[model samples]
Target chain A: MLTKRIIPCLDIKDNRVVKGIKFLGLRDAGDPVEVARIYEEQLADELVFLDITASYENRKTLVNLVEEIAQNIFMPFTVGGGIRDSNDIRELLNAGADKVSINTQAVKCPDLITESSRKFGSQCIVVAIDAKKENDGWQVYINGGRTPVDLNAVEWAKKANELGAGEILLTSMDYDGTKDGYDLELTKNVVEAVSIPVIASGGAGKLEHFYDCFSQTGASACLAASLFHYQEYTIKQVKDFLKGKGVSVRQ
Target chain B: MIAIIDYGMGNIHSVQKALEHFGAKTVVTNNPKDIETSDKAILPGVGAFDDAMSELKKQKLIAALNKHIRQKKTFLGICLGMQLLLQNSEEANKSDGLGILEGEVRRFLDRKGFAVPHMGWNQLKIKNKNCPLLKDTPDNSYVYFCHSYYPQPKDKNIIAAVTDYGVDFTSILWQDNIYGVQFHPEKSQQTGLKILENFVNLC
Candidate 1:
């Protein structure tokens, strides 16, 4: 059975793990490696490190940091941000990063997805589509939720899957940092539309929210940052709750 | 000395780093001279079977590998690297393998809605009760898995461990000095690193 995964996302800027409210107003979390170690000890199913600025930066420190994590922690984790070409993807994976996520670069040159997937294999490629609701329709956002993309959310997911993206990380910008819950409608909409695994991100406030998102939306996994960062809930506690709710967590 | 064969397949650096992490003197090499002189050889591959074979043949590393394997040297294969040790793969078409181990690779047909590439952590069912590779690893412990095809060994003596995805499938195979893991030991965290350490300390 496909176990429902819980991943703690570390947003790296310059090299440190930081989080912001609604994609703005940054706050320091802690050492990236220490935080990662905590999550691993808590039995986190996986970890996601996004160089929120990987695409914009001249050079990325996330790859080095990810290598540090890979040296100690052994569970599979995906590194997103600034994966522009096959070489970048190959570098990250070769560095012990299990998977690499692509956003703006993938949209601008869709060939990145197909080429990376073809060269390295699809399971190693992830297409993370950042979206927000606008006038009853989801609009895709790129460049760390700073740029608006022309492709439709569902359509882009289909294209990515067709291009050999094994997983889709759909994030709701509107609900992000709100602590209300996920944009169920949007998450469900995209999950139903794609055969590939969908990870619902943004606006995960409480344990029930995870249950609600997984039960109602049928997402393969739920990803959160703020909650885990602030110690709002330990992953084990949340997984225990979800397991009680009959969700298959990697126990 | 561990020579990680770099055939332009997947990430060889990480594999080397992991080996070096365990204090193994490792060299990432494609040259036959380097491999022949190394104490052990590790084949790390990612991508289609046919292309990996083509790359090995194109670079003439297969003959070097055959010579080394015939000398009873330690060889470790990872992911597609592991699958390539078998007879052939059903990924795209029938492709020849290194044949260092007795097995054939086949796509994992869908079972209970399991995706094609069985990604993420899954438990391993060890067959050889005294398998040294699984020393500290727990029974049914969740090891990272990312692949579509599993090795079907012709000889049960080589079966080190099995993992259940659809039905029971081969997760790890060890024959004489040749060892192959479908899961990345370098990526499996503690358990994975332990396997690598054991391989390094192999007598």
Candidate 2:
């Protein structure tokens, strides 16, 4: 049986690990390679490195950083942000990233998901959805969560999966940075809506939050940045807590 | 040298890195001569069976791989590579495979409710206690996996280990000189590295 995964997300800017609170107020955490190495040693099931930088030059630096981390670390790592086309996804995969997450571009071109999934396998195509609670339902946000699209979060998730997205990285804007907990309602709805694995992101503040997300939702994985970047809890600590709660977690 | 057969399929860099990390000299190549000259060969693949087979044929690696395996050479196939060792796969419009192993690749829908692509880490239930590749690796050890289909080998004797998602399927296959795994050892972390080390030290 597949064990629940504990992933530490690294938000990268200019080749450095940066943490953004509610998608704002950037703070340096550490070097991408160094922080990735630590997460691997801490037994993080997987690592996610989102190249938060928008410039073409910074994207190159992120690729270089990905190579450095891949050379030093052995676990599966995902690279996201600024992935515009299949070529970008290929470049990152060739650079040693195990998977590539597409958010803004996937929304613009759902065929990009189909094309990439066909070129590469669906195993490597991760579609990330940044969603904020709107009215009674969640609305999809793009362009670093600054723009709200007309698509509904649940509806878009279903569409993304139908378009050949292997996994869904669902982030609840309402709960991001506040760390109250993952938006369980949104996560559960998304998980039920999609057949593929759903990774519950944003609003993970405490160890119990991890347990709650896993136990409450059908999420295959839980990802956090500040909780891990700030060193409030190590990956080991989170896993230990989950294991104690009778959740099947990889050791 | 351990040659990682890269027939324009999946990323072989991580596999190369893992082997070299354990002090094994390795090369990722598609050249028939390079594959033929290596002491052992590792076939790592990703993507559909039809495309993988076409690429292997395009690169002229199909013959080289079969010849090497015919002489009882050491070999390991990961994910799509492992599925290719089977007779055929249900994926990619029921494409034919290498026929190295006597079996048909089936999808996970046979057992409902489980995810189609069995992604993330899973435990191994040892079936072949004496399999060299799993020498030090404990039973039920966690290994990373990402695939929609699992091999249902015809001959049960060749099975080395099995993992259950919705159905009990072959996770590891070993027959004489050829070996294959449905999971990615390179991505399985410590236990995965240990399996690669065991494969590296295999006599």
- RMSD for each of the candidates: 3.5, 2.9
lDDT of 1 by residue, A74-102 (tens): 57788887777787887788767878888
Name the best candidate (by lDDT).
Answer: 2
| Poorly placed runs, candidate 1 (over 4 Å) | A20-30, A55-57, A60-63, A134-137, B93-95, B110-112
Residues A114-161, candidate 2, lDDT per residue (tens digit)? 999888888889999999988899999999999999999999999988
Q: In candidate 2 chain A, what residue range of length 10 has the lowest lDDT sum? A: A20-29
Residue-level lDDT tens digits of model 2 in B1-203: 98898777767778898999989999889899888888899999877788898898889998889988987889998999999998988885745889998989988782323655678999999999899999989999999998888898999999999998866789999998889999999988889999999999997
Best by DockQ: 2
Off by over 4 Å in 2: A20-29, B110-113
Chain B TM-scores, listed for every candidate in order, come to 0.96, 0.96
